[model samples]
Target: MVNITINGKIVQAEEGEMLLSVIRRLKIDVPALCHHEAVEPLGACRLCMVEITKEDWNGWSKFVTSCLYPVEPDLIVLTHSDQVNEIRRTIMDLYLARHPNSPEIQKLAEEYGVLKTSYEVQVDGDNCILCGICTRICDAMGFHAISLVGRGHGKTVAPPLDEPPPDCTGCLSCALNCPTNFIEFSDQGNKRTIWKKDFEMLACVKCGATTITREFAEFLSRNRDIPFEYFETCDACHRKETSLSMGRIAAWTKEAQS
Candidate 1:
């Protein structure tokens, strides 16, 4: 057992615990995006960076992502700091721009004293946040159906070949595990959304949200090999995608040229 000061309060934690995990275990509630309890620490999101001081280490820790940092004996940890807040705010802004209307992001922003950003992505009450929490959590379930695809600004959750991951086993673990309803699923931990086809599903085009039959998505990918992770069509715009695909087919006869 090692004793350390956190936020100026002395606290005792295990010798080799990750700083982030130790903080959460102590009920510190640090903000997290890429950190998960089940998977190897990826540290991609860089959300849980912390400020620390200790006998072994002094000065700021810079932006060391807490999700991957090992705790040091006698270390003083500050989970929240003005610098941390600024970086976190910027991260939230980027997420908002991409997803725009994710309730989870919105809630996080509100908690950090950031009510709005200079740019707000269009909010249609049905936007997928694309935060990656669901995908990360899916690792815990051993079902890798949904995942982050592409790179940088163009990244998104996808299956395989942009098609649904075949080994999905129809588990909607992603949706049930998602902090935001960006992905589709029926029951939590049910391996059905990753499999099946020909489902009666309803989607919201603006937000790309699914209102019914998330399992149907698996049908398209697992059965047809089409990347059907995103919304096919909302109940209101079901014909739009089809019409666009089919184009304008008018049957006005050949006029009266005859």
Candidate 2:
């Protein structure tokens, strides 16, 4: 366990635990995006920056991303100091400049009192804040289906070549992990398309229910050596079938006694 002072209150945190996790544990108010507990911290949003003063420092404090920074002994942290609030407002302004119409961005702007931005708004019908959460989660899933492309003014997240790559398995992890809801999805009949890549849907043989994407099923079967018979039944039908089989065995045992 490590002891650190957060907003002048001493708190105990597990060794090597992230500062953001500790801050959240302390119930300290801190705004953050591009942070998911299940996925590794990217620290791309910079909205969770906190001012920290080292024990040996000569009254000098430095700002660091709370999501990636770990707790240590004798560390003095400020969650919402003047410096921290200033930095957060500036970062939110930059995000608003790029995504003016986003409710999430606008909400944060309202909270931080950021009414306007000096930077020129880039109007390209894009609402992505470029937090990279979608791309990071996709890479973590081992699909590497989507990623942030280009640089500077041209930087944007998209599939490779701005078209769906064959590597995408239609996992929908990217769309699910997207904080800004930038990823689009379309489902029509047996086909489901996301990012311009269409995937066939697998249906349960018994219930005729759409089970999952054919690409996802194939990927799982190929990687885990799962049998085709397992995919033939959907989750609900499989549970029902298992219950019925168990009941039949119990009935046979009762009949044998008679």
Candidate 3:
């Protein structure tokens, strides 16, 4: 365990743990858009930047992204210092300029007191903040189906050759995990569409409701050692069955005791 001072409060944190995790553990309201526990921290979004210094630094403090900075003994962290707030506001201003249409960005910027961007706004811009969360989640799901393609302004998340990803199982991990909700997918009855690809969804045998794509079920069965029949029922129906079985077990136990 390492002891560190956060906002003038001494707190103990695990050595080598990221500062953002510790800050979150303390229930500090730090805004971080590109952070997800499922993947490694990329520090793509600079919103979680905090001022850090040590007593031996001669009163000099440096700004660092909390998501990437690890906890060290006697480390001092200022999560909401004046300089840190200004830096976050500047970054939010740029985000508003780039993603003017994104409600998420707008709301966050407003909270940071960045009502209007000083830079020119991209009115036709998509909601994608390019935080890379979607792509990272896709890779974490073992599907490497999409990635940031091109460079600079031309960069975007897309499949190979801008075509439907052949490896995508329509599992919706990328879409669901996206911080900005940029990825779009539609479900209609037993059909699912995403990234211009169509997939056949599995219907629950008990409730006749759509559950997951057949491809995802098959993949989980093959790789995770789960039986494919497990996906035959929806989650709600599975819970119901579990409750009934537990009730029967309790009754059997009571009768045996008597």
Best by lDDT: 3
lDDT of 1 by residue, 102-141 (tens): 7787898888876777675655434555557767766655
- Encode model 3's per-residue lDDT on 1-258: one tens digit a residue: 978999999999999999999999999999999999999999998999999999999999999999999889999999999999999999999999989988888899999999999999888889887889988989998999999999999889999998999999999988888878899999899999999999999999988888789999999999999998899999999999999999999999999999
User: In candidate 2, what residue range of length 10 has the lowest lDDT sum?
Assistant: 121-130
- Among all windows of 10 consecutive residues in model 3, the one with the lowest summed lDDT is 122-131
Give me the runs in candidate 3 sitting further than 4 Å from their true place: 243-258
Backbone Cα, N, C clashes tallied per candidate:
11, 0, 0
For model 2, residues 106-216, the per-residue Cα lDDT tens digits are 888889999887789877747787888888888877888878899997888888888778899887888877777778898777788988988988988888788679889
How accurate locally, in lDDT, is each candidate?
0.66, 0.87, 0.94
Judge candidate 2 at residue 41 and give its lDDT: 88
Best candidate (score: TM-score): 3
Q: Which stretches of candidate 1 lie over 4 Å from their true place?
A: 55-61, 120-132, 137-140, 186-258
TM per prediction: 0.64, 0.89, 0.94
Error of 1 at 84 (Å): 1.9
Q: Candidate 1: how large is its RMSD?
A: 17.7
Ranking of models by TM-score? 3, 2, 1
Which candidate order results from sorting by lDDT in descending order? Answer: 3, 2, 1
